[model samples]
Target: MKQNLDLAPVGNCSVSALIDRCGRYVWACAPRVDGDPVFSALMDGDDPEHGFWEVCLADLKDVEQAYIKNTPVLRTVLTDTNGSAVEIIDFAPRHHKHHRTYRPVAFGRIIRPISGAPRICVRLRPSADWGARRAEATSGSNHIRYHCTDLTLRLTTDCPVSHILEERTFRLETPLAFFLGPDEGYDQEVGPGVAATLDRTVVYWKDWVRTLYIPLDFQDAVIRAAITLKLCAYEETGAIVAAMTTSVPEFPESGRNWDYRFCWIRDAYYTVRALNRLGAVDILENYLVYLRNLVDNSAGGHIQPVYGVGLEADLSERIVDSVEGYRGMKPVRVGNQAHEHLQHDVYGQIVLPLVQSFYDQRLIRPGSVEDFCALEAVGDRAYALHDQPDAGLWEFRTIARVHTYSSVMCWAACDRLAKAADALGLADRAEVWSQRADTIRARVEAEAYIPEEGRFGASFGGRELDASLLQLVDLGFLDPMDPRQVATFNAIERDLKKGPYLFRYVEPDDFGEPETAFNFCTFWFIEALHLNGRTAEAREIFEQMLSRRTHAGLLSEDIALGTDELWGNYPQTYSLVGIINCAVLLSRSWTDVR
Candidate 1:
C-alpha cells in the first residue's frame, strides 16, 4: 500500500490509527495521541520497514473499504484477480466493562476469507525513537512481544506464528484474530473476545449516533462529521485535539507543519458549539470539567491558548531530525509553541463554552452563582485586554497586532455573560457587563473600520482584508442587515477570494503568502452568505465544498485551491466543525422534510 491522504481513522477516544484504503495501518500513537509514535510510516518517507501493519494479498487486484453502517468500525475487502477475496475488519476495542468504558491501548484486526483460496501475508512493523530504530520482536506459539525502547507491545494472534514471523504467503483457510496491545496476556478466548469486542463496539457507536438531531438535508455529511469530531475527543480528560496526525504540512514544502495533538481552547469551543447544535451534550458536559481545571489553575491570572489533553501546561516545540516528514517533507515537529503565545481571544473562547452550562439543565452540574463568579474573572481579562496587541487568532509568530476579531470576541464574551446574569436574576452584574460590551463594541467600530475602503480591516487602523471579518455578524457586533457588514463581506470577497475557496488573508505573514485555503474560513463564508439573504448561492457553494471531501467524507486543515487536494493535518476538528455548521445552516429544516 502507498501513502495516501484518503485514509480512515479508527479510534477508541484514547488512541487512534489512520488506515489507508488498502487496509494498511499508516499512522498510530500509543498510550495517548501525543505519546511516542509506535507506527510512524505516515511521516517516514520510503523506508523499507516503514513502521506499518499491513495484510497484503499475494495477487491483489481490487480493494473496497467502508464503515460498518453508522459506526466507526471499518471493513475492507481485497479481491484477487482470480475470484479469491478476503475481508479485514479494523477497529479499536471500545465497549462497556464493569460499568466503565473499556478502551485499552490496543488495536484489533480480524481477518476472514470471504471467497475461494485467498492467499495473504500479515506484515507488522512498529518503530521507536521517532522511526529511527525498528522494533525487535520475540514470538511464542500464540503471541509476539515487540520491544520498542521505552515500551513494548504484545501481539496476541490466532494465526500460525511462523507465517507472521517469516512473512510467508499462505492459502486462506480459516478466520484469524490479532490484538496488538501493551504487554499483557490475552483473554480466555482470542476469537470470541475479539468478536464480542467488535459486536459491542458497533452497538456502542450506532446507539450513540441515534441520539443526534440531524438536519433534513445533508444527513450523511452531518453524521460523518459528528463521528469524526467525536473521534478527536480524548474522553478521559474531555480535551478535543485539533487533528489526529502531526506535521502533515499546510502546503507542499511550505514549512508550515505543526503538531495539533493538543487541545486549543478556541478550537474546542467551536467543536462544542457544533456538537451542541446537533443535540450532543455529552461532549460539552465532559469538557466543562476541563475548563474548570483550567480556570482553577489560572489562579485568576493569564490563560494559555492551548494545553495538553491531560491538562499539562508546558508544551515546548521541537523537531525530530531523524524522522522524515510526510512524503519526504522535512522538519516533522512534535510539540506546539502556541501554548506560550499571548492569544487574548482565548478569554472570550473560554467563557463561550462555560456559559452554556448555565442554561442547559441537562448537564450533570448546572452553572450556579459561583460558576458565574468564576466566569467573570475570565471575562475581566477579556475586558481589560480587548485593546492590547496579541498574537491574534492567526497566531502570527513574527508580529502582534490589535486584531478587530479579538475585540469583537471580547464584546461577545461580555454580552453573553450579561444575558446569563440576567437569566440568573443578577441585575447589577448584568448591567455592568452590558455596559462593558457596548464600550468594547464602540471601540471596535471606531478603530477597526476604514471609511474610505467601506470595509473593516484585520487590525485596528489598518486596511488589510481578512476572512475573519465575515464573522462580525455571527458575533452580534453588527446586525446581518447592516450595510457596513455587507460592504465588509463584499470587500473580503474581492480581496481574499480564490475561486471557490477563501484565503485566511491576502497579506504576507511570517511565512510569506499562504499556500492554500483554510477550510473553516470557507464554511464561515457560506454562513455569512446565508445570513446575508444569499441562500441560493450559499447552498450552491456548500455543495461544492462537500464534493471536495475525501472518499471517506473527511477534510484536512487546508485545501489547495488550484488542485483541490487536501493538505495539512488529517481529519482536522475545525474542518469537521465546518461540515456540521454548514449542514445545519444550509439543510432544509426537519419540519419541512417530515
Candidate 2:
C-alpha cells in the first residue's frame, strides 16, 4: 500500500493536523476588525469540497516547505507532475516598520514566484460567509475582476494568464500574479507585482522580526507565536488584537463563541509584556504611546474592555445562525457582546500595560491632566470593592463567581497605581493606593488561600481550582516556592490535569459544551510545574504538548482527546505565547520543576 500523504495547513508539528476527509489547505480572511467576516472556518468546519483555497494532492506530495530564516516569508516548493519544480513565496509588504491601526485600511500585499519555469495554475474564489455569495468574474488582458455584492477583487500579475476562467468557471496556469494595493497607482489598474515586490516583503518581515530581543530558548511553536503576534499587531495603532478571528468556537457543536479580532485592553497587557520579553520593546513602547494618546483623549471614559482594530469603540453582535460551526460548533456570533459587559477587571488589565511600559523602557509620555484622571478614575474603581465578586479573568456570561483570580488582578490594579504614582512623585495619593493594595493583599491571603485544603481556590470560599491563579509568577505576589504557590500548583495538577492536557478550570464552563483541553491552561501548567521544581515533569509534558501540533506547527484553542483533532480557535496568540515562554524558561533549567 502507498504511504498516506497529508498536507498539513499549520505545518508546525505532525500530530495536530486538522485533516479534512480530503484535507488539502485552509483559508483565513478576517475583515476590518469591527466588520463582518469575509471568510470563517470558525463559523463552519472545513468543507474541503467548497473551500476558498483548494489544494491538489500532487501539490502535497511534491511540495517542500520552509520560511525565509528569521522572517515570515512563507516559501513553498512545488514540483509539477511534468517533472519540474517551482518556488512560491508570499508576504505582505508595508511602508511602515510598525503599523498602529486607528482606522481600517487596505494592506500592502504581494505573492512572488521564483525559480523553476513550470507552468503554474491558480484559482481566486473570494467568498462571503462560507461561499454564500457567488462573485462575478470578468477577464482583462492583465487582470481578473471578481465582483460580489459591494465587494470587488481584481487579481493582476506579471505572470501570464493562460487558461483563464471566471468566478465559478475560472482557473489558470500563469507564471505570476499581483494583488493591487489601490487602483490609484496602477495604469488601467497596475500596482505591485510578483517579480517587482518580492524583495520589499522579504525585507519588511525579516527586519521587523529582527528587532525582537527574545530572552529564552525558542522552539518552532514559540517562534511562530512571536511571529503571529507581529502579524496581529496593527501597524497604524500599537493595539494588538487578541486573536485573528471572530466566531471560532472553543468547542464545535456548541453555541459558545465570540469575536477575537479586536484589541482588548485586558489581553493587550499580556501581549505587550510577552512581546517585550522577546526584546521587541518597540511594540509595547509604541502601544503605550497609543494608550497614552487614548488616555489623554476625552473619550477615554468610554473605554470598553476591547476595541475595534481601527479604534472604533462601537461593537455589536449579529447571529449568523444559518452557517454551521467549525467542526460543528454553532449559531455563530460575529461581534463581541462582552464589549457591553461592565467588567470591573478592566481597570487592572489596562493598568498593567501602563505600569510595565514605564518599568521596562522608562517610556512615560509627557503626562497630562487627562492621563492623571484616567489613572485616578481606574484607581478609584479599584478601591471600591477589592474583595467583592465581579467578572473574573475568564469573563463567563453567567452569574459572577467570587473569582480569586479577578480579586488578585484587582489587587494588582491598586498595587501598580501606587507604584506608578510613587515613581512619578504623586506622593499624597500613594498612601491611599498603597492602603488599597494592602487591603486586597490581606483579603487574598485571608480568604483566598485555604490552609486546611493546603491550596488556593479559584474563587473566594470555593473548592474549585483554576489554572489562571498560576499567573502569580508574573505578578510578584507569590514566590513559586511558597507553600501556597506549590500547593496551588499541585492542586491544579491534580484537578485540571487529564493525561497530558489541562483544563481551564475544574468548575463548570458555560461555553455550552466541554471543549478540547484549553490551550493556555496547558502552557500555564507547564510554567507552574517548571517554576514549582517539577521541571522534569514539566519538560516531559511540554515535549508531549508540542508533539500534537499540525504539520505547520499551528494549534487551536482546544484539542479533541479521542482523535486529537485541533479544535477551538485557530492560531491562538496566548497559547503560542504560553508554549514559547515555557520553552524559553525550560531551556534554561527544568531543575526547579525537576
Give the best candidate by lDDT. Answer: 1
What lDDT is reached at residue 494 by model 1?
A: 83
Give the lowest summed-lDDT range of ten residues in model 2.
11-20
What would the per-residue lDDT of candidate 1 be over residues 160-242, giving only the tens digit for each residue? 89888999989878999989988989966898888888999999999999999998899889998998899899999999999
Q: Return the lDDT, model 2, position 436.
A: 90
Clashing pairs in 1: none
**Tens digit per residue, CA lDDT, model 2, 1-594:** 111112222211100112222222233443343443333333445452332433232333366776666555556666656555555554444433346311112222233334344544454444564445434566677766655333455656553544435223222234444552222334533333444445655665567666765534544566666776666676566777776555666654566677776777777777776777777766777677667655555243644667766666667877776456555556666677777765666667777777764344345454444465577776666657567666677777775777787777778889888887777788887788899999988888888878897888887888777888888767877898888888888788887788888888655656544656887788888888777778999889888778876555656677666666665555666777676677777885435445
For candidate 2, the per-residue lDDT at 335 reads 71
lDDT of every model, 2 decimals: 0.90, 0.60
Instruction: Provide TM-scores for the models.
Output: 0.98, 0.84
Highest TM-score model number: 1
Model 2's C-alpha root-mean-square deviation from the true structure amounts to 5.4
